[model samples]
Target: MRLSTDSPSINDSKSSNKHNANELAPRPTSIKDTGIQESVLLELMLKHLLSGGVLTKAQLVNKMGITGGIIQELFDKAKGLAWVENRQSSAEGHMRFALSEAGDRYAKQASMKSGYRGLVPVPLAQYSKICRLQSSRRNPITFEMLQNGLKALVLPNDLLHKIGPALNSSRPVLIYGPPGTGKSYLCRNLNATLGDSVLIPYAIAIGTEVIQVYDPQLHHAVDNNNESAQLDLVQGHDPRWIECKRPLRITGGELTAEMLEVQFDSHSRTYMAPIQLKANNGILLLDDLGRQRISAKQLFNRWIIPMEERRDFLSMQSGEHFEIPFELILLFSTNLNPNELVDDAFLRRLGYKIHFDALDEPLYRKIWFQVCEEQGLSCSEEMFQHLVNDYHHLLEKPLIPCYPRDLLGIMGDQISFMELKPVVTKALIAEAWSIYFVQA
Candidate 1:
């Protein structure tokens, strides 16, 4: 995808100046500034021409995510080597080019070396610097910002106060609570508090090894038409880096040890970056912490250094180790007891340990009415009382936040199925409660 010169979200605090200044890596002026060797750039161009067959200069610029001038320089070099030849000019007056017989052979050899045929990658050193710079320049979270970000959710002011400082600290947060208490939902919304956009490269290069960093599934691009036009008038924004909202990535019980490391594809000869690396300058939530495929102790051991030093170590297939800034909010959410999952020593390393409990009657009622409004059903005080007194209190079930939405959803489904008006009746509540909760 092409990069845009989008301004950061205005809600961000003034403390983000450092980040905003260096957020966009200046557009490279030459192949040397690209930080990629000439031979590597040639191979990349050859591979694109080989796969696409007879492409225009504009097409190569778009596919390579580089400036047209750099593409021209590469084209000139290729012409001298007889690896590429000029074709008929396009209707738009753009010069078209195609690979020579020898260029096709060279591209095949390049593919055999590594099949990665996408945007030219940022150098590992440049990427590492950007990660560290953005991490250190994060805007401090305020109580007002936190409250404003999570205004849609029904949460206590005390909890907001606890979370605001923890986020500003930029340290690991341990949120332990019972199931259905909204820990996961709360963590997801925390990204909204970080109002600024971040630059994520499509990929990063360590010598010849390429690691893909940007995932469309995780990073949501922001449009900056006005800013982009202004930037174009002055200096172009680097197409190599995509402007995106701060990413929020979550991994639950299915997480494996292998997922936390760089994955190399033998056939393709390219590397896929781990989740934490993708989550740089953002938040990474380890949901359902204690139930991962790997043991909790093993998981803790794997990240212990990164957690403490704020940098992680990853190795290429060749066993050459490199350091990347572990610049992200690491949030651990679990329904299980923290003590049982890990010893106090590990817990001590965490910045904050916040607890989430069952909601009280007032909070429960507030969420209930909110859900009723959301589901387009009339809220009934009598039916709500019956649900609380008969189902929750009688059955000794705690009033969890998720119960309102779940029970109301079940009732809405039944009403729709039975062709009845959208109303909350005691009988409907009973049926929904029965279906939602198992009876002994």
Candidate 2:
């Protein structure tokens, strides 16, 4: 069974809604959208269902990068939207879902909106709201705190001045560079440097209010109106630890549009936010910019509204759109050309674009020696020069300061393997580079 994009619904048609109010509906529902991006594989399965087929959780996990928990989240959302109809086993014990009238509409909308996208910066506007509340709750970081953090990084004088005002104001800061450039490291250190405790929200879900259907503890006191009855939110076993430390959501290229949306549960009927929502009030680093499945332009287009306005709109699966704050330090790390990646209009949203060029010879030497001393790798100046001058020529690559750190690591592994003395050698460095980095 395969779904067709051109030919509209061949079977499931939206049923007529007649009765209201006093009519005893099968289920009282709140049509909220679950902003989770349905994976291509899942979409394929749904398309198959439209043509007439079924999928088990096992088949789902095998096809998609999703796990049982995430799949359940999807099912719950669909069930709430009334997009699926449960059918009893005709001759087998297994149960399956068929596409419903609402499901067809949902599928069509999903197809129109779906495309594997990047999650980085997509949730900036959403996170902004979360941080505003989080910041207000934690109180703002004073100037002293900000200055101390900047000093600790030993940032260049020019860079410090450029970043200081941005920090003082509400403008977002971006750090662009290659891998191992310490982008994430410096951002994480912001919490400690700020001298403030960033609050991490424990998303206390109000269960799919099948009139309060989601029961986490089997005996939970979930109340929407009475702010007094606080739901005890626990991710895993025992439900004790709060896990409330402010988090830095480190996302690679696995980001998408749906992830920026809100979700609603059908069975247990609750909402689970995307990772960016969870990373609210903290730093969000799009570690590898060009590596995502989504085009850099497509992603930048969606972010334009949120970045400029400091507010992003989130659509509920129920088709309701709401605005959220865009609180976050959006860092785009890539090795690609900036001009080629994003245009002028897109670039304007970012307050600061700090490009970290390859370290010069002097800095390279300093970094190399610092790493070597820290790692306890024994090698004389003569040996270091020989390796740098020799292998670098053979490799035809510039002296990346990171090379020494990588070479030291390789030497350690070789020593451990061969049972050699505690020292590094040109041979070890050469062999490791050949194995790991010599591909290109």
Candidate 3:
């Protein structure tokens, strides 16, 4: 049965505990606020009661993520139909409830169809609405914004300016460079520069199929414990939506072509939305691009249609298809040559193809001191010069930005192992450098 937003669900009318308007996580006040069908919710409640055997009204509310009054209304409805019975009073003002024989049979049939029984899921239609409303393209990035976001990192002005515009375009970014040139680092900073935040649902329901969306690993929630925001929760924003920083999801060499599609568990009768689905309205970085088990050509082929249409078609085992929004900054970072990985036609699809080259002597030296300062080690100019001139120049090795941090890390490790104060000496530099570079 369709859930009507016009009437307040049982608990919403009685609850006086209101949330502040500015509160980041506004608790859903009613069944309508959850944005899923009431019939689906009724079945979920029955399943919970069947599995739990007996549960308090408050416990059911907590388990279902619905307000107490709504749970009360559901119990009343179930009791009237004899689908559930109030066994006894578990606690003061809390009634213990259990499924009736009919309810058990109904739950069994429901479980046979789909074993989902958890948080009341937001309908896919509602999820799509929220995603489109909070699309990353809506938030524009300025040069100043990019600079402020990456202020912690030492990036050159030329590179900064180029990145500013590239990110603003909101198209595919190809960050190609040799290893240790900070291609991945730049992509991370660029993602931060997108600024603002987006709302992500806890889970999405398509018919009876529920697909979980909130991942603690991928989604970083904003600190919303402010007094004013808490006070504003009285009216309540939808609890299903979580205010999170625009996600920066990274995948490396382990990624395969199958991972790009919606994954279903036949045993559990549930669907897990793909990475791109979770990555909607943010940046999805494919790190070590060409190194994925799936060849670059195969990967590009998978993305081409989504790239052009700005939507992806995901299929279920039952041959059901869903067209989901494809609105994220797709970033591809690789140490390998772009030409060798994907042909020119695919390269044309990328809006910005920037190359990160090894650092020059001046930049290299600047980074050397920075690494020293960060590592709490003293920098000796003589030692740095000796290493650069004698080792880098003499050996014909290019100075890469990552070398300073890496070499100093080894020096620090050695000092720690020996219980010596960390200092850059010619001997120490030589030792670290020797360990860092492979013998030709």
Candidate achieving the largest lDDT: 1
Deviating ranges (above 4 Å) for candidate 1: 1-23, 224-234
Model 3 TM: 0.87
lDDT of 2: 0.50
Q: Give the TM-score of candidate 2.
A: 0.56
1 or 3: which has the higher lDDT?
1
Clash number for each model: 0, 27, 11
Sort by lDDT, top down from the best: 1, 3, 2
Task: Please write out the lDDT profile of model 3 over residues 1-440, one tens digit for every residue.
Answer: 00121234435522311222124345665667666777788888998988899998667765676677677667777878789977878657656888889989988998887777766787777677666656656546666767777887777789887777777675688999889888888777766565555667767887767787778899877634221322122444554566667788899998988889878777887677789988998889999988899999998898888887778888766777777888788889998989999889999988799889877788899989998998899977888899899999999889888888999999999999988878888878888988999987
Clashes of 1: 0
Which parts of model 2 are misplaced by more than 4 Å?
A: 1-169, 178-180, 184-190, 204-243, 265-268, 393-396
Which residue window of length 10 is worst by lDDT in model 1? 225-234
The alpha-carbon deviation from the true structure for residue 131 of candidate 3, after best TM-score superposition, in angstroms, is 0.8
lDDT of 1 at 122: 93
Best of the two (1, 2) by TM-score:
1
Q: Rank the candidates by TM-score, best first.
A: 1, 3, 2
Using TM-score as the measure, the top candidate is: 1
| Alpha-carbon lDDT, every model | 0.84, 0.50, 0.76
